[model samples]
Target: LRADIYPTLESPSATDWADRMALPVASIMWTPVASVTPDTDIRRVAQVLLDTRLPGLPVVDDNGLLTGFVSRTDILRAVANDPPLDVWG
Candidate 1:
């Protein structure tokens, strides 16, 4: 199937290069994105990371505020030096 592949924080590797060549570009593509607010719960944020496979999510607060962003690395740090918890659930 043809689809747009956006690069994440990490650099694209050889596998990614191969995929880009193998797949054809689709005429139209729609990807649903999930955003988080400042008040959003950490559990939910972790869930989003697992579900979306996105490196990060934009953090938009209520009152139309743009506070900052959150990434997988940020979550890793939160879990201390140990491995991150199972976010799959």
Candidate 2:
């Protein structure tokens, strides 16, 4: 039978430990960047959003500077049926 123990298993190698320690911390922002032009229609914008599979698209001017963001929630909210679901922290 299996037992519930506070500490278990063999010790990890120093190399393995060091590799884990060398990794970046969780505080880093890890989202992919997506951009779109100002004149692009919502239909085309929707396609880009789907192709990229990202939550938000960064709206940009002709010069490729960030102007605004169009998120998944924004797209979902556009339809009259239902609101997007809440995700808990």
Candidate 3:
């Protein structure tokens, strides 16, 4: 999760803050970013999300177009509504 989501104190101290403000955002963002294509396998995409610990992944097309996005919550909701799998010994 992004650190910005947390609430800050009204009079927060900056003594503990790092000197990272001068760095460009691109330098701090994750590299070789993971993404899913329109035709990407659902199972593979889910696994990637689980492995990367990212809330969601950008959905791109073969032409490198940003079509949409998918998130862990979306997958969980889908699985919750789908029929359960049957198993037998």
Best model number under TM-score: 3
Better of 1 and 2 by TM-score: 1
Ranking by lDDT: 3, 1, 2
Instruction: Provide the overall lDDT of each model, using Cα atoms, as 2-decimal numbers.
Output: 0.71, 0.66, 0.73
The candidate maximizing lDDT is 3
TM-score of each: 0.53, 0.50, 0.67
TM-score winner between candidates 2 and 3: 3
- Local error of candidate 1 at residue 45 (angstroms): 0.3
TM-score of 2: 0.50
User: Candidate 2, which ten residues in sequence have the lowest lDDT sum?
Assistant: 1-10
Off by over 4 Å in 1: 1-32, 81-89
Task: Write the number of the candidate with greater lDDT, choosing between 1 and 3.
Answer: 3
Instruction: Report the alpha-carbon TM-score of model 3 versus the true structure.
Output: 0.67
Backbone clash count for every predicted candidate, in the order shown: 0, 0, 0
Instruction: List CA RMSD, all candidates.
Output: 8.8, 11.6, 5.9
lDDT of 1 by residue, 1-89 (tens): 22235444256678876776686545233344477998788779989989977788889868656689999888778775456466665
What does candidate 3's lDDT look like per residue over 5-84, in tens digits? 22353443454234444567786677777889988887888899989878899999887788999999878776766755
